[model samples]
Target: MGAHQITIVDMDIVETSNLHRQALYTEDDALNMVPKVHAIKEHIARINHHVDVQTYYQEITSNNIEDILDEVKPDIVIDGMDHFKIRYLINEVCHKHQIPWVYGAAVGNKGTVYGIDFKGPCLKCLLKQMPSSGESCAINGVLPTIITQVASYEVAEVLRYLSGEGFSKKLITIDTWHIDFKAMNVDILKNHACEICANQHYSLLETKHQQHIESLCGRTYLFRYQSSIFEHAHHLPGEIVKSTSFAKLIKDDDYEITLFKDGRMNVYGIEDDEEAFKLYHSYLKALK
Candidate 1:
């Protein structure tokens, strides 16, 4: 498949642990501590100079999803998103825009893939109740086989949908460790009247549910839904690397860390929120 342009967006930087499953990243990238979007963009550019590559060094949240999608205006959006909240945001925005997107997720050698054609069986059907803290590839661990398998299948579906060939509406689940593949039908779309699929309602776009602290213009991207655990800047348990009225930056061997007094953190130098949260919790424990 030949595409004129591709836009890659992510809020985190490359990490050592991600190399096993995140196929596009390399050891050098992790060591260099480059942002994931930047590293991927450079890699793609080097591989194919003809294809235009664009990257957004920011997380895809409900607030920014619509704007990003509108700006990119891609033929189809691929679901490289890590968790359900953002994925659900993607589903809602894509369907609302009448755009098609593939939904994919993998953890513990198991991978799931399905196409949302803006037609039937959107993600909301499968996930009636979103977990407060969902299972992620980071927490449960993942094998490269499953990640690539699901990604490749998602690409195939994208191509099929773009080529007028269409894609299977059935939910495709793969157990790569066991070498088992199942394409089973999910009846949630048939049974439940999904507000997303039935009515053209995407409330996530307007909702400001995620706890965000924006003091600086563009220095960091921080999104933590939890309430504050620390009250004041002086109460910061971690040895303060630098302190300011607006925020406090900390030192971490792995992460370029920034923590607010209210317990909000903006962790740079690592890819994905899981690792950032891990560091954040460890610091909290150390303080205790």
Candidate 2:
């Protein structure tokens, strides 16, 4: 715990939305469209020159999880993701290797944190089954204060675990808006028939998650997806609402669309997937 290394893995770039909760970036970073991992690495270096920080500007997919874990060899992993698909993957991988990890999540004014180690309850213990559908942070929205609180709790657990001190194995829930804090007992959950921890069956580790990539087979996905519009002159269409290295967003009253440099696109304003594909196809045809 005295001298340690940190590995930050995230494929996303800094945006106006991230500046609020994630203290690692600034408005300048959001405006300039800096990669999240790269920007945070710089920030950490400035704060502590001694700390060895490794950054991966890539997504946490099943394909590369093993390689990344092998290369970094972290003492403990932190759960910063909001998605469940990846959360389960992390739980399985960490549990399989007897590694400790802190799982934390924040949404709106509410947040939750739980310490997961080989002896403690794994994520599967909390939610016996994989949830069908979820409301993403993108849709539900999250408060910056809530995020900070959740992250702080997660860091505290990490410190405790590393120092060989007893950590809270219970689920810690907090609501910053209401100033409510509660530690829910997870004894029953932990003792339950958790296929993951009980049987040591890490299903996620054995199976390959099908990646639905829109990019062509030969084309490489951009490590840093930033739009030149963030720092360069642009002749793009629409209002040019948001620009990232990977894609340029153009939105108007009628249409909200994002066009990727890899020839992938999505139309969110429209409900129909076919219609969105058609719109992207027509736009591509026009470009040609």
Q: Which structure among the candidates has the greatest TM-score? A: 2
Give the local distance difference test score of model 1. 0.71
lDDT of 2 by residue, 160-244 (tens): 9888885677799999999999998767668556788889887777787544322211111112223332333143346776666
Tens-place lDDT digits, model 1, residues 1-288 = 667888898766676968876878899877656778888888888899888889887656777887888888878888986667778888888888888889998877899999887777788888877644334533666787888999989988888898998777778999998999998765445424787887767788779665543321122335342335444434444456655433455664655565544455665555545655665556556545
Predictions in order: lDDT: 0.71, 0.71
**What are the runs in model 2 whose C-alpha is more than 4 Å off?**
1-3, 132-139, 213-288
Q: For residue 4, what is the lDDT in candidate 2?
A: 55
How do the predictions measure up, each by TM-score? 0.76, 0.78
Kindly report which residue pairs in candidate 1 clash with one another: 13-270
Angstrom error of the Cα, residue 178, model 1: value is 1.0
- Return the TM-score for candidate 1, rounded to 2 decimals: 0.76
